[model samples]
Target: MRTAICDMLGIELPLLAFSHCRDVVAAVTNAGGFGVLGAVTHTPEQLEHELAWIDEQVGGKPYGVDIIVPEKYEGQGEALSLDDLAARIPPEHHAFVDRLLREHGIDTTDRAELAGRGMNISDRIGERLLDVVFRHPVKLVANALGVPPRYMIDRARAEGVSVAALVGAKEHALRQVEAGVDILVAQGTEAGGHCGEVTTMVLVPEVVEAVKDVREVPVLAAGGIVTGRQMAAAIALGAAGAWTGSVWLTTEEAETAPYTVRKMVAATSRDTVRSRGRTGKPSRQLASAWTRAWDGPDSPGTLPLPLQSLVSEPALRHLDTLAEKGDRGAQELATYWVGQGVGLMNRVRPAKDVVYEIAEDFAEAAERLTGAIGD
Candidate 1:
């Protein structure tokens, strides 16, 4: 459990669990591992409330926050209102979604209210979120999309918070290190959410070697790492530790919809696909009718970042509600961000138990490795 990340983040274990659920964040931190709350979906007001609640639960344990501020996207430098952004989405895209929903036997009629429901991912919003984050006791701040914006790194450094950025390519890792990131999460395509084409086994060592000359920046291997044995493997591959996300989706404290959880449990390594249907980028999720329609041959194609987000979230939100109510079609079209590791996540356990198990498993794997050195 002793590693650079453990010391840097001030935790007993190097296992870092990323979850959107506040309960999971507090539970993992309290159990010894670090928890990073996903804040891209939360508004400033909501983030303040969520952070305050986590502050009360963890009793001073260190934690982190993840925000998506892509380095390049539609309307990056533009000042557009939510209405202005929504207006850019063409009618064909909406019609395509409506047809897809209807094919699944759900009603998408007169749903104009769903139009501006997408999460905003602009510089202005990211700066506002950073302001909220700095006001709290967050020890680490992570960006998953691209290099942490210059202001983000500067502000985090000013506030004495470690800046962590997730990169899939060795080139991206170099960029983050050059940009002064305190830590690097070398994520692979097996990871949930937005990811690149590299595999973890290759990317970890590649990134570690790529940045050694620059400085001794710690790298956490991410993508489909669910078990302590996998965490041990990541360390063997030259990672300081493991950064995990999908594994926590099935934990008891997760807020994943009941039906989607069932689909995930029944899934295997081959069940997920890297489709851009969700956020207009290739994110790994359980393949469903929604993903297939957008990635299919006769489709109009996906939109750019936040613009594509506007079209998808509203419709998916509606389907999720019906899926919870036993609408079989909705369930068939239901999907959530997950990785190939879903095959091993067949059981649901408390977040604390999951954290303890990973730590214990890591120790056992380390002993086994040591024993191999002799005899």
Candidate 2:
């Protein structure tokens, strides 16, 4: 609780809950832990609206915003239209998606209409979102993938907002430190969403040790850390706090689709897999018929970031709709981003209760450790 991250963020607990739901964000912050809104899904206007709503809800509690500005994507430098990117998606990929849907008894007739409607995750959009974020009283701004852009870092510094970067490897951690990130989220493969191959147990200490000489930025251990016991373990491994996502998905205030939330509550850690089927980057998600279809031997390989998203998001969105309507096939195919820690998330509780539980459990874990040392 006395970690540097707590002091820097002005939070009582170092548990940072990342969620797309503003309710969860405000609830966690009011519960004494920091809440960071996942802003990748929001456009500038949407982000502004959400932040305003969060500001009113939290009543002056400090919160953070996370945006995805990946280090690499299909359109890294050159400007490309959504039509251009959609055109580049191989016909085979489309056929595979169409076939996958039809086989599941879901209609794919309006697939094209749904393809590019989702939020575009690019530097251009990120900058616009950042513009909106800087005008607000955000305590932290984090880049979910790759290094935070120099402009973002500089702008956050100028705004007196701390910048954080999520990294899966020690090398990436060092690069972020060199890039002047104020906080490092050492995310392991067990994490949901885009993640690298290393496990948290190994990657956390490796990153902490590797970044010791480069800079002393606060390291938050992420990936499959859903409880205070896990948070205590992360601290034992040299993390200042725990950066959690999956556990929040099951919280009462979470905006996770109802069907998906049911699936998550029923899932075990082994029920998740790391597949590039969703975001075109290796991210741990609930292992479902959808992921299995993409991982099968007959499947076409995945495309990169935005391209992969274009193909998958629309289809998944439709599947979710059908699943909600009680389509068994859609239910089997319904999956969402979640980590291996989902097994422990067996029930839905209020977001505030979750924070208090983590704090209480973390205190007990610390006491047990002290007892072990004969203190």
Candidate 3:
């Protein structure tokens, strides 16, 4: 816990939990760890409200916000409307979704009853969310997918907020450093959500060595890091801290869909697969009927980022509704982006308990390593 990251974050421990749920964020921060809110899915207005509520709950504890601005996606400076983006999704994809829904006995006729009926919006909305977080007391702002855009980096620097970038490769970490990112998140394939082929055990040291003399910025080990032992290992390998995500999904405060949380509890490390079916980029999620369809040779290849997002997002929303109503096939098809760490999460616990457990475990692990020296 006496690492550079703990000093930078002004906390006793260096466990950084990335979560979407406000309760989890508050709990982790209160337990002397950093809780980062994943804000890519929320609108600016909603994000502002969530941050304000977290501010009140954590009583001025430091936290972070994460956003997604992929280097390549469907709507790049074209200024496409939400309808335009929606239309780009091919009719065949829609038919495929409809067929899946019906095969699972989900009602397609009643669009009004859809779970996320009114939530669809434009990609430009993310900029507004970024602005809102900057106005608050957030200590860090992270770009989840790529190098920090110049505008975002400039704006955060102007506001005196630290900017972090998540990267799957050492090359990407170098690019982020060149772009003036204050921190590099070396995320490996074992991570949930978007990731690259390198394992955390390999990628962390590689990224650290790659950027060692460039700027002295911190490197947090990410991807498939779920326990105190894992955190200790990352620190031993030159990581300043452990950047985590999937562990939060099983927290009591998590907003994870009830059934999805159940699935995570029951899952093994091999239960997840990396596929482009969800976010266009390769993200690890539970292997299910939907993933099988996209990976099948007879099916059309998956589309690019936002285009693929367009198809997957609506279908997931619909699946949630069907899943709640006892549609077993739809339930079986239902999946969310999570890492192989799901196997390690056995029960729902409070986020603070999670933080303390990591700290305690990290101490024991470190002590054991020291004892092995037999000095």
Candidate 4:
């Protein structure tokens, strides 16, 4: 299980769990893997509070933080208020969302009230959150959508923290290394959340070979890596570790909506789709009525980045609430970001059990591989 990443991050297992839920992060970290908190959705105050709570739970175990600062978006570099961002979304898009919900017999009375509460997709907001993150004792800070902002890199270095970036292509990996990132997460399209159209099997090695001459940076294979066998495969492909997100969604400590978790547990690998309906960026999520409605031929086209969030988040939030209340239509429409590996995640286990099981499986896989090679 030893690798350069383990040495750098001071973690036992090379598995890095990314989750929005602090409980999942702490549980994984406590169980011997590195836990990275997805802080893109948290406000500065919320991030500060969550980090403090995680610090208390992990008892000095190393952890990381992930923030999204997309390279391109609707209002890049603008200091627009949430209300201003919401105003930029077209009225037709709003109508289209309402029509979709009504067609499914879901009520949308409080939909307007739910707007403007989406995750921060702007660099400006990310910087503010970074201010809060550097104040904490986090061992790593990651930028998910694009290169890490210069301020983020400089601040992390000043605070003695490592900087990581997620990339979907070899060129992106090279760009990150040239930008001085300490770690690169080669995330394939099968990954949940915003991703490009490259498969993990191809992207991992491509990135590894591409970045070797640039610098000896650690590459963590991500996207659809749920099992220890997959982790082993990633290592065989020249990855130093695995950066996982989807598997944690079905864990007992996950903050995923109850209805969404049920859907993920029952889902097959073929049951997901990469669509821009959710985030205006291609993210692999459960293929539900919601995604279908947006992707259908008659639907209005999606917006870009934060603008698309303005259109989708309110409706999705309402659907989650209704689904929780046992509305059949809402339940059918309930979906969350998950990788193709979800087909294998059929049960809800504790986060610690997941970490231990993955470690054991990885060991067994390695033993089998070694045994295959004759003396």
TM-score of each: 0.98, 0.97, 0.96, 0.98
User: What does the lDDT read for residue 296 in candidate 4?
Assistant: 92
Model 4, 134-219: lDDT tens digits are 87789999987788778888888888999999999998898899899999999999998888999999999999999999899999
Cα deviation at 4, candidate 4, in Å, is 0.7
Q: Select the stronger candidate by lDDT from 1 and 4.
A: 1
lDDT of each: 0.90, 0.90, 0.84, 0.90
- Model 3: per-residue Cα lDDT over 1-375, one tens digit each: 488878777777888899988899889999999989988778778899999999999898899998877776776778877677777878887777777677767777875443232222345666677789887899988886777678889889898888989999989889899989998899999999889999999999999999987889899999888899999999998999999999999999998878888889999999999998887778899999888888777566777776777777777866765777777987888998889888898899988888888888898999999999968
The Cα error of candidate 1 at residue 163, in Å, is 0.3
Question: What does the lDDT read for residue 220 in candidate 3?
Answer: 96
Q: Write the per-residue lDDT of candidate 1 for residues 1-375, one digit (tens) a residue.
A: 588999999998899999999999999999999999999888889999999999999988999999888888787788777777888899999889888888888877767645547766765899999989988899999997888788999999999999999999999999889989999999999988888999998999999999999989999999999999999999999998999999899999999988888888889999999999998999999999889989999789999988888889988877887999999889988888999898888888899999988988888998899999966
Off by over 4 Å in 2: none
> Which candidate model has the greater TM-score, 1 or 3?
1
Q: What is the lDDT of residue 317 in candidate 3?
A: 68
Model 3, which residues run further than 4 Å from truth? 112-124
What tens digits encode model 2's per-residue C-alpha lDDT throughout 151-219?
899999999999999999988899999999999999999999889999999999999999998778999
